[model samples]
Target: MKNVLIVDDERSFLSSVSEGLSAYAAEFNTLTAENGKKAIEILNSTQVDLVVTDLKMPEMDGFELLAYMSRQFPDIPVIVMTAYGTPEIKERVQSMRVSQYLEKPLDFKELVDKIFLELAASSEGYIRGITLPTFLQLVEMERKTCTLKITSKGRIGYLYFNEGQLIGAETETDKGEKAAYEIVCWEDAEIEIESICRRKHRNISTTLGHIIMEGFRLKDEKERAVEKENIIEVGIEETGEVDGEEEIILETLEKEEKMNTLKDILNEFTKLQSVTAVCLVGRDGFLLDSIARTGIDTEMVGAIASSGFGAAESMGRQLGKGELTMSMLEFENGPVMFSPVGENAFLVIVAEKDANLGMIRLKLKKHSHELAAVAAI
Candidate 1:
């Protein structure tokens, strides 16, 4: 659940706001403060997720509190409020990391929406604003599972969390796991988790073995294209040519004809028994496309490979030398080979952990030039 701390200098304002929040049904643990001093003490002692404070106060102004929060606990979302929304105050509040600023005679709906957005974001292990859903999806793709337990009114509930979203409940309720799943998915359930225990017992979307078989099947299909002749060829293929765009087009046809057999040529490398997936991605890492056994996001895998290879390039540049020749990444159950085909492309092959690296490296070396030319297309 998102925790909200509201601070105002006016005693009546504090009481009314707190009482109003109480009167209205909501899913938040709301706290109130009449002064900044009490707010600070509470902030230091408690895990206050979001803060709403008045611009002008006795001890510390909203801006002062903003500055303090920014310096110390920058992750906490702050929203500055004031009756007089002068240009100066607006600009000042905006300058800080305040999530939202509100004028007097607050629009409760807007405030509620902003609060909901802020709290939703904060619940995803984010203090301040950061890209979400994408990160959350990435975690889901990884198939992570845990227990999210929250406490309220002295009663704590344990909800089962899968990947990054709450999937169900560890503790049986009146309705059971089905209700927990529905509640977490549809309702804005604040998993005010008092504790978390990561127990990876749940099944993932795809298994490693399944991914490998699909990769091998892709390689087999590529092999059938072998008997074709090079009716054309493309480029300044890999190396740049002095000729301009017109010639590049002519070269493209040539490349197409040559590569009519390119996939087949890649196939000649002998698809390993351990191959889970064989994907062809551009040098920049955009997946030209892929072949996977299971429901894996081939696009994401392509992106990850591209990103890793990009980082590798950066590492090479930092040394002022040493071009990235070949690279390999090993997981517990499998490994990925980053075989550079040319100046701007690579051949990625996923193999089982137990697969022979020597054979894979040899095949990559043999097909390095051919893969580069194909990728350039």
Candidate 2:
């Protein structure tokens, strides 16, 4: 039996859905959460097949949860139920890769139908699966405005199309044109589409056809490099008569080197007294790395930052302005600044209320190129 997770602040609605699903859709079991935070906790502990969520809630809303899932559980399809069916909300949800969007006063049976349809389609054979490049081409040909959730290998990617023109793309730790290239190159990808495109500005200026062609070129180059490296490794292993443990040690050492590089960069940000927290968040809204003082929720901060940045960027586009370079949100007690570190990731800086914005921006600008290099690797 499949396990379905439902989230809403209304206890009565939650109870009704849980009981109704059991009675009407006997093939599935249900779990419930009062808000996004609780839903995330349940998701961490339980193995869930599908998520049905409401848009607005206290603490964490549907948008934040959707962003989180796009990174951590891209393979799972989500159905969004919202009382507010505004165009802006629809566009935002689409950009976040929601599987289905339904307005409030939802017909329970219709919701169940969407759930079962998504589950069934995902279970189909390899031949019937949606090919990532082909789907994008079709979207372009049809002039469809929608968001696509793509699962390739172990990563989840999101593609937003405005009237069939590719505008934005995102992955767990990447975004924009680079994310688009990486996503289309992966094999055996599964796709989920929801109509609506919220992104206003175009982060990927390249044509879709060109981007797809480039993706293929990159994939071919990567494969050739890997093959050459593997041949060299095999020859060395034969000559040295190395055991499995030695190979494991070499792999561990390589990983440690990468981690050290990331740590060194994070340490530099933490050294600032005005900075209370520094987090690197992927375009898909996942936390890549973070350093924080005590009493901070780094994961939540990353999620909120990703959403805020995307929304602001979209608004800029809609206004015929250029891409978003940096944004600052000031609260009563503190201020938060967000900036694009690279095409794939962003930096979120939390500082005291009286922190020096000018100095922080200057420092961030100075190290932006170095940070981008680190992020790319």
Which whole-number lDDT from 0 to 100 does residue 205 have in model 2? 86
Query: Using Cα atoms with residue i matched to residue i, what is each candidate's TM-score against the true structure?
Result: 0.33, 0.36
- Sequence-dependent TM-score of model 2: 0.36
- For model 2, the local distance difference test gives 0.73
Q: What local lDDT score does residue 301 receive in model 2, on the 0 to 100 scale?
A: 92
User: lDDT tens string, model 1, 180-201?
Assistant: 3222222122232222435445
Residue 206 in model 2: shift from native, Å? 13
Best by lDDT: 2
Off by over 4 Å in 2: 84-98, 125-377
Candidate 1: which stretches are off by over 4 Å? 23-26, 84-97, 129-377
Each prediction's Cα lDDT score?
0.57, 0.73
**lDDT of candidate model 1 versus the reference:** 0.57
